[model samples]
Target: MVRAPFLFALLAAAPASFAQQATLSNGTMHVQEGTTLRFTGPLQFTIGPAGALINDGLIDLGTQAVVVEPVGSPISGSGVEMAVTATDGPFNATAPGGLGLSLTTNTATGPITVTRGHLARVFPEGDPSIARWFRLEAPGGGSAPVDVVLSYDATELNGLSGSAIGLYQSTQEDGPWSSLASTNDAAQYTVSATLPAPWDFITAFDQDAPTASASLVARNGVEVWPTLTHGPLFIQVKDGAALEELDLFDGLGRLVTPAMHQRSSTFASMDLSGLANGPYFLRIGQRTTIKLRKE
Candidate 1:
């Protein structure tokens, strides 16, 4: 009675963006039951205890952020689903960082299902500073009550004041968070949240400020490599710091490359092996942008 050899992967319906920081560190990433792993950004599923992640379909965590660690390796999806699309209209409230949520937004009124646990890691022991929680749940039988319009970047909320900017709710993910009931358009930084009927893991904390590490190349520590590579594509820049400007985009966002404006040193190697496989978007220096998958 031994059966454990069924692995499938079909995630190419167009819409798989990983703008830096993705670590699945081991193996076993079985997403083959219904097929759908539409990610847009932020991912970290280091399940090691034999490593296993059987997700059924639909895992669009577009607002970014996802962390599943060795919580004992248990992420079996019963048609597993999770979504985040709530970015409509004017949202550059003077933009500084963090505020680009999506999963193909039409201003979602649905798709927020995260049945059965395992997405944990807001800070599960290692705090790089703060801010690292991701959750979504609302698709079980009845399903209804997922109205989100959250947007934040009022200079990254440190200036607070959008009525304080809080909409935290949690059923325990190392959180006692409970604020929910929001609606602050503080000059269009946006915040309308409502998960009414017995909420299930929502996060947008700003108890005063601190949770906005908006990574302009991870705050200048910079390091980009093998983001699903096949050839040359490296950019280090840590203490050496010199590599300024570098642009290249494809995958509809256009801007094919031709903006290496000049100034390089701290280890830069971009020879994409001639480029022409799939996703691409790298805009280092003046405001980071990363997502390369030319394999």
Candidate 2:
């Protein structure tokens, strides 16, 4: 019943290396804020029934396997609790090949494990850009919703831009994958989403398709360029009239205001970097509403 904070609590021998495997039979393990607990190698790390992990820091399991055994004896009907908080920092868990998870969850009924790999090579229902998957397993599920942040590499985009990426989840490995309302950080190559319940499989997909170079159209003395823009959108007034008012609407016609917008007498630009990839309607002053796309 030793209650040490981190790695020292488990391995009292030599420095943990790639050849060793750490097993926790029982007791609560805590990873304090700003600290990182990493386990690397081909061996498996197991946490038995009487064991628990409370992580508020980063846990890097580079190509390693972590098994959280189920607590058959549910204490007061609550089996085992493993709370992972990822909102405070960058991300909590990271695996090989650019798969990461910043998960927020409550108690679990059974074993919980994370594996990196693709469930299917090609999913025709969603983005065909990338095919990597991160599978999280929790038998009976948890209490609160889980926030997930997945990072990716530009090479894996399959010719798609990073800003056009989003998260998609499916209960099974095969078909019927649904898109999640996620925010993409093109600079960091990360996509984030909040799942109401536990999902079996999650992957990154490109929600916006590439448009032809001729999509840019100008009318009524108002001009916009590179219709398929990655971030900054430029607007110019051909007649040199004040741009007056400007507004943006999403695919559903929902009004969305850009966080970074600058305007002068006849020229203006909006930073569409934080926006999702889709078709949007940009309204300029009165009587001029041009259609555009954001990637």
Best candidate, TM-score: 2
Global Cα lDDT for candidate 2: 0.57
lDDT of all predictions: 0.47, 0.57
Model 1 weakest 10-residue run by lDDT: 123-132
lDDT of 1 by residue, 1-295 (tens): 1025433333233225433444444466767656777655554323455556666654555545453445434455444445443343222221111222221222233434342222322421121211223354433521344455555344344324666554555555654344455566677766656555455555454433322232223334677766656656777778666777776765433466432322467766766666677655566655355555565
lDDT of 2 by residue, 44-140 (tens): 4556666655554545654443433343311111112122221222233433222345554443324345554422234432336353566665545
Worst 10 residues of 2 by lDDT: 73-82
Which candidate should be chosen as best, given lDDT against the real structure?
2
| Model 1 error, position 50 (Å) | 42
Mind sharing the TM-score for model 1? 0.21
